[model samples]
Target: MSREKLLEVQDLKQHFRTGKHSVVKAVDGITFDIYKGETFGLVGESGCGKSTTGRSIIRLYNATDGDVKFRGVSVHGKKSKDDLRIFNQKMQMIFQDPYASLNPRMTVMDIVAEGLDINNLAKTPKERQARVHELLETVGLSKEHANRYPHEFSGGQRQRIGIARALAVDPEFIIADEPISALDVSIQAQVVNLLKDLQDKHGYTYLFIAHDLSMVKYISDRIGVMYFGKMVEIAESDELYKNPLHPYTKSLLSAIPLPDPDYERTRRRVEYDPERDNDKSEEPVFREVKEGHWVLCTSKEFEQYKEDLVE
Candidate 1:
């Protein structure tokens, strides 16, 4: 991973007002950075605000507070048409549900070419057709598949269409929000491998959001564990897996199933009891307990984590 920062998210909050008196904090005060040419994985259970973080960063939903900077420019607040256009071109998103994300009415060719059309990336129909064909092949699809509608393809194929659309504009960064979760288990690895291959070919930076820790660990250079709309741990992927410091992270890691039946039978499951672990005296803060590992903890818990690392 490159040391140059590609994206910076500082204290991002996304809240929804359900009623006149009720509010939901979908994403509350989270911060992280994605470096150029690295895949930063965001993992948590469903509804843990991982998806919301990706959407808010891409401006799909207006952030209620904090800042998201791409390169050096702030993505929040009002901006000129040119600025918005630039932002859209530089950042793209692949939605979670491939079945719902694609327009069933449009042909695959039109779907993939939409971004190219909007950005005027291709000047002529011939150029557009060539670009669409190139993208289809890049994502392991054929030129013949382009004429078919979304309903004609399977879930994995539909996701490839989504990926083609995202790459049509040649974006520098992509936010993949559970792109493989909707596919069959057999197909999931195919899609994930395709993404890794693409990233390898084109030095693209990624904010890969998903609930599958095993899959995330496979593709990510760094990983951040989220809980209840807050980041509980952040570290290099292997480091986080080998030495999990946060209770929630340990609970999450312990839940990953192995192929060995013997190991599965013997594996110790650690249930996360927030009531027992949380210190209500003071709210815990995100602090670095080691050179690159960070965890949300109070001073007392921080000391304990440090001693645990030593031992």
Candidate 2:
């Protein structure tokens, strides 16, 4: 990973009005940065706002507060259509559900060429077709499948098509929201390998959102842990795995399936009590306990975390 910053999400929040006087804080005051050409993994259980964080960064959901900066430009709101177009061109998303994301009415070519069409990137029909064909090849598909609809392909192939669509405009960043979660166990590795190959070739920065901790560790240089709409820990992958600081993180690591049957049988799962773990009086802020490692904790908790690391 390079030292250059690509995307910065500062205290980002996404709140939804569910009723007359009630608001659901889907994401509350989360902060992290995606470095240039690095895959930053965001991991958490479902309903922890990992998907919301991805959507907010891509402007699918306008953040209710705080700012998301892409290469130092604000992405939240009130941008001109032209500016938004540029933002869309620069950053793209590969949604979790291939079935829901692809248009059954549209052919693979049309779906893949959607971004190009929106940005007016191609000059002619032939150019668009050529671009679509190229993108299909890029994602391990072929021109022969261009005329087919979404329903015709398998889950993995449909996801490849989604990857193709995200790459149509040569985007600098891609928000892959649980891209592999819907696929078979065998196919998951293939999709992830494809992403890694693409990143190596094109130097694409990724916000890889998933609940799969082991997969995240394999793909991401750095990982951030989220819980109940809050970012609890952020660190280099190996560092986080070897020395997880937060109670929630320890519990999460404990749950990861070990390779050995002996170890698995003997391993004890660390039970996390959210009410017991988090202090209500003073909200914790993310503090760096060591170089390149961050954890959210109150002042007293920070000292304890530091001491724990030392021990």
How many times do residue backbones clash in model 2?
Answer: 0
**What value of lDDT does candidate 1 attain over all alpha carbons?**
0.94
Per-prediction TM-score to the true structure, in the order listed: 0.98, 0.96
lDDT of candidate 2 over 1-311, digit per residue (tens): 44989999999999999999999999999999989989999999999999999999998888999999999999986989899899899999999998999999999999999999999999999999999999999999999999999999999999999999999988999999999999999999999999999999999999999998999999999999999999999999999998899999999889999779999989999999979887766878899999889999998888888888843
Clashing pairs in 2: none
lDDT of each: 0.94, 0.94
> In each prediction, how many residue pairs overlap at the backbone (N, C-alpha, C within less than 3 A)?
0, 0
Q: How far is 33's C-alpha from truth in model 1 (Å)?
A: 0.5
